[model samples]
Target: MVNETPQVMTIAGTDSSGGAGMTADLNTFAAHGIYGANVVVSITAQNTQGVRQVQMITPDMVMAQLKAVADDLAIRAVKTGMLGDADTVHTVAKALQQFDFGPLILDPVMVAKGGAQLLSDAAVEAVRTALMPLATLITPNIPEAEVLTGMTIQTPDEIMAAADKLHAFGTQNILIKGGHGDAPVVMDYVRLTSGDHFWMKTTRFDTQRTHGTGDTISAAITAQLGLGLDLKSAIIAGKAYVDATIRDGILVGHGYGPLNHLAVVTAQNQPEVYDDI
Candidate 1:
């Protein structure tokens, strides 16, 4: 008997909107044809519009969930997002360090779409000290890159500078998403600590349905890695998936909006116009 499918895990918060967090992560993995495992860190009271409130899960519960999944299933790859606070990040990092499981993807989720604080200033240090070193890759938007690097990223050159600063934190690869900048095209730059670089460019979709795009991108990358794609290839594929999802946006919420999670699976066999990638 052949299992034929890779398994990936997402350690993230829960979005009640069914758009972001674990829900989106699992859906993205499914879209990428991977079995998804998940560990919920926080329960967010959010809808299509924005995050209303967040309920932080205890560190002990997080540890228990990670241990339970790792002890049972062979997680081929893992992605971490929205760890709530410093303690939660440390706990997850400690468990990962203790068990030493699969390849890890870290999405530095510092703020929500509505400009809400998702990670604390104190916890940012914890993420750098504890988790960033163990990550196979770190996906950070421009704001997140600024937070992590303490440098303003206004141009593509500055984006490279930010990536270099993040590399010093021990992350193997840094995917700095340039969607937040003033560029007409969304250029996501992938730089490896080993001096390898890949740039993926897609015309920016002028839509507000970017709420869960980051989570979806990181999740898709993890799933692709689980399916044995190299880091650069996975990121390239992930960006394509995200761009497609945004293109297929349904405009669900009144505020920020949600992505089209099913677009990938539905369009998998369809022709690639290069728009969907």
Candidate 2:
């Protein structure tokens, strides 16, 4: 037997600006020391500015890519981002059932960072009915949580309620992110079926570089899962990584900026005298 890097696969859309979608997923996986494999589900004409258009990949193409990857790789963890429509969502769910893969981290990507509709209204049901149940953990930001759970989240308690509601949908765990607020402290609520709940609170970074943060967080958790970390630990690690990335993020373009996936570069480059040989 030979030692090989852990593999993580992402099924998501393509972000033309390279700040999100499959691009962000690959970067996050590489940063976490995992091999990233992906199947593009849609294409978005987007950037830090906004989304101008979207073109979804055909169901046949999605299925082919998934089959090609599943047949060839020992995928330790999987994450999903954007599914353009109900048919695509159904197709992805069907493929997952056929493959019988586990430990899926779902991002529930309905809209873009700049407020663009990525998924159609008709697809939400398909996602909830098909994909949500298959997820080991579903990571939903406040707005997405609102849509999925049909409750207006106004406070921390409401966030917990939203998590509970989402749990009723068959997902094993829920991470309701409260990062979209005017408050200084961002709160994230995680609920497990075992009656364990974690409230992770962090100081809000004072910046507009929120672009792709959700994708990064989802990918980070998936990578940790791929490396055999427990679900809670993976969530914690992923949250820390996302927070730090936001803290050290770059201000790019005229609109919302991007996360600093290269934050670990300096640490990786630090001298190891014995290893210099």
Candidate 3:
């Protein structure tokens, strides 16, 4: 029998810019040879400069879209992006709860790279309390992690602590991204439910084309999981894929541009994937 290609789903918003959200998730899924299905929860009148306006889809519509996909696709893994509000968040969690979509990789998208609030303030708690517990892996950058744990993350040790708190939030895995800070190296902390944890570091590239980094990485992880990789392997591979994307930055719109997802990179071109254990 021939091996079947894995199918993945991205439940997120839309970026007209084609740099982030569903666009980037689908791009990353394609790059990994995984079929991608999407459920658009919001639409932003946005480009590289910034998000000018956001119109969230209704909860019923979002659920309907989800139902349409689940009714047909054999979605092996899933990732969640920008759920617009508390109600939408609840709706997504409720619907997703009714099915087994394999591993749940959650990207708690709060603010955009241009400093626009993609998620409402009230929904922060909703995401943490309502949906986060259902996650197999939660990918949160520095600010999002701080908001979730209500703790400051300056020291590397604090990053570990934040991962602990997020793990307590009920996810079996946690990837606390440190790319938001200005440091010589981008440090990412990963902790699994089995008490296994490690810090991965790569030389940070200073550039404006890092707009869709979070979506890309989380989608990569989900795709890998769909293809049968374990959580640790998926996380490591996700970081490597994101590092390549960021390193090969491309010029898109005026402001912070999008990553060159089509950049040609073999395993030889990527950096050392993990740091001291």
Candidate 4:
């Protein structure tokens, strides 16, 4: 038998701060004992403070990086985050079709914590039409879900309704993060294509260290998929990892600080953040 280490790829942007984007993805993949590959779609001059500047890599270069990784690596799963523009989003959509990476987790990173625009308004439509159909799972935060469904989400019923709208867009699974909610306990909603849904709730952590939380969670899910976990298990495991990660936060910058990627997590070490709802 061959020595097999699951290979995972992240197609997204880079954070100069090394807290989010490609840096965080590689870190998460490594933490799961998986081989990590990357295709940089953009680069940002960002730190714990915030994103100061952004430069989108050309679509051709993005495709080239994907080609290099696809040709040599046996990528078992892949996740996308922070595609800077409409062209980059479409470019990734095409590559996902051309390549056979196992599971596709699309994190619709639209805006930064410090009011920086990561994805343009036009790019949002591109992601919906082009990327959604190709994704195995689409993980969007509350605000993003609002934009995608063209409606407001104030209640849990509305959250599930938004998931319905997202489901019609073509992904088999939908996870709308509730971190932006005003509730004392944060709840993340997940829905399968068959209309089945699950809720994972954890008391909100009062902190400003959630910079790369989105990318980190999606990365963990992708790595878990590469390791042969089912979709539901992968998502819940991702939540557990993120919950532990946020709980172990450290001060890396003045603004939205980075998550504690160094936090070693196991099924046992995972906090009792799960709630029945």
lDDT of each: 0.85, 0.85, 0.88, 0.88
Identify the runs in model 1 with alpha carbons over 4 angstroms from their true place: 1-5, 265-277
TM-score of each: 0.93, 0.93, 0.95, 0.95
lDDT of 3 by residue, 1-277 (tens): 3326578999999999999999999999999888999999999899988999999899999999888888877889999998879999999899879987888999999999999998888799899888999999999999999999999889888988898899888878899888986788888888889878788878888888898999999998999999999898888888888888888777788888998777655673354545443
Tens digits of per-residue lDDT for model 4 on 204-227? 888889989999999999989999
RMSD per candidate (Å) reads 3.5, 6.6, 1.8, 1.9
Candidate 1 per-residue lDDT over residues 65-105, each given as its tens digit: 99998787778889999998999999999998887558899
Consecutive 10-residue window with the lowest summed lDDT within model 3: 268-277
Supply the TM-score for candidate 4. 0.95
Pitting candidate 2 against candidate 3, the one with the higher lDDT is 3
CA deviation > 4 Å runs, candidate 3? 1-4, 268-277
Name the Cα RMSD for model 3.
Answer: 1.8
By TM-score, the best candidate is 3
lDDT for 53 (candidate 1): 93
Best-to-worst order by TM-score is: 3, 4, 2, 1
Model 2 has an lDDT value of: 0.85
